[model samples]
Target: MPRAQQIRSRSISASPFLKWAGGKNQLLKDILPRLPEKISVYYEPFIGGGALFFALASQRRFKKAVIGDRNPVLVDAYQTVRDDVEALIEQLGPHAAHATDAEYFYWMRALDPSSMSRVERTARLLFLNKTCFNGLFRVNRRGQFNVPFGRYKNPTVLNPDLLRACSEVLQGVDIVEGDFEALAERAGPNDTIYFDPPYVPLSATSSFTAYDRHPFGRSEHARLARAYRACLARGATALLSNSDCEETRKLYRGLWVETVAATRAINVVASKRGQVNEVLVVGRRQSAPALRQVGASGHAVTSSSSLRRSRAAG
Candidate 1:
């Protein structure tokens, strides 16, 4: 059978295929309810793991969806999942078979992505992501995949069902690869834009801002803030999340801000891994109402005492 004909077409629930730093998997319950009740178009500019997008997709929440990211490799992986999933899956089998061998993991990581075919590149990325340390997509200054091998007891490098489900949900979606500022021009009235840009580092040492070769610095944060405000001015509902720090607060000043607890999963010091407060900023069109506050587990935070109580629980 032809490769295209071999691909199955069916509706199945999906989740983010890759484990990403700052992914919204844990915050979905709190974030989902805050989305606009009716969405004409959905936009997620920094669609990392796309936890929110996949969740909304499963619910059939919008007429159409547009997802973008600055990282080309990441965008390519998503495209492969959407269009060339069968080939990508076939390529992953060998990787999965040898996933436990550290030598093979290092060899795969060292290979240049440009030298590989699209499906091969996508498969390599998936393999590394699943087996790499903490499942992080960190690259070195030379644009190399440098994360060490993770000694997982049984890492799942190939998930045919989840990939097929992702492909199905992505049937009509438009995927873009570039800076998030473009959303200001692309998003308009009746649209809901979710900005999950690289968060401003709470402390200088805690920076996960090197998403790609380009570092998301303070200037990028300022530029994104402007783009976000522009989307709001153009009559779109915008939602964003970031570290609950003075810097992040300054960026979204005057916008509806909600504090929520999030577990810090990717940290060098194991002791520092725990529940931490993060801010959710909402910017809506003039007609939209203020966003309701939700705690870590998606329950409403009605009062200061309740907020304190929630923090204590975290």
Candidate 2:
């Protein structure tokens, strides 16, 4: 077996997928157990970087899985990987070399996604994602890639094995490019929905991390809160992650919410790097963290449990 095969031998995990900021690489373990076992379909609408999809697809095979993103570039990248990955890898060759400057960022951004063939567009998205600052996919109000160049020495510009593995599970998934609310018409009972929306703006003064040019404001948050409530009323299981902020807690107060700290590269500022507390609000009730163990593997596990299932999938 090849080196990649050894990693694949483990259950589905959150690794191998491209690294991106706000990706759910951490904070999936506790959320997974809360998921119901009889769900016929798995749906993720706000699939930012899709850390959860890649993780869940590893162990179980759902009859139907739907993944979508509002960002057209992100959707195109997933489509190319599922449709034809070889061409994507080939198109990414030019960017495999290093070019750490703001000018290069614009140049890559300017390359038309539709002007190029599908394969070329897919390759461009992959290359920019690998080399861009903090693996972030951000745009300014004018829709330009404004993130600064990240300090990485020879990042994995392309991963042939990983793309192939991801394609295997996405063979028949309904990948779409649209708003999260667009799925409401098709969402049925017993479906599993894992939402990782832009958290209730951690603070009023925080930088713009909105999913799109239009900020997901308080009204939008209330809309989503109502949607989740409706989903629960209709018997759909829901698990969503948001910043452990007052607004978030207030929005989800009546529901069962548990706080767990999952550290990632969210804190761009040097001071707040290691630990960021996020709330995992579930439609179903959870015994408070008072009885759980904050595992080294980024989940709240039972303290007396013996089986140690790590979601890292490494």
| Best candidate (score: TM-score) | 1
Candidate 1 weakest lDDT stretch, 10 residues: 305-314
Alpha-carbon lDDT, every model? 0.81, 0.68
What's the number of clashes in each of the models? 0, 1
Which residue runs does candidate 1 get wrong by more than 4 Å?
Answer: 1-12, 284-314
lDDT of 2 by residue, 195-231 (tens): 8877776676764564356677788788888777776
Per-residue error (Å), model 2, residue 39: 2.4
The per-residue C-alpha lDDT of model 2 at residue 308 equals 26
RMSD of 2: 6.1
**Residue-wise C-alpha lDDT for candidate 1, range 1-314, written one tens digit per residue:** 24553354343468899888899999886677677656899999899999999988877778999998989989999998999888888989989998788999999998999998889999999999999888888888889988899999899999887888888888899999988887557888988899988888889798887778898999989988888889888888888888888888777776766788999887767888799998777653233343445556434344333121111111
* TM-score of each prediction: 0.89, 0.83
* Pairs in clash, predicted candidate 2: 12-58
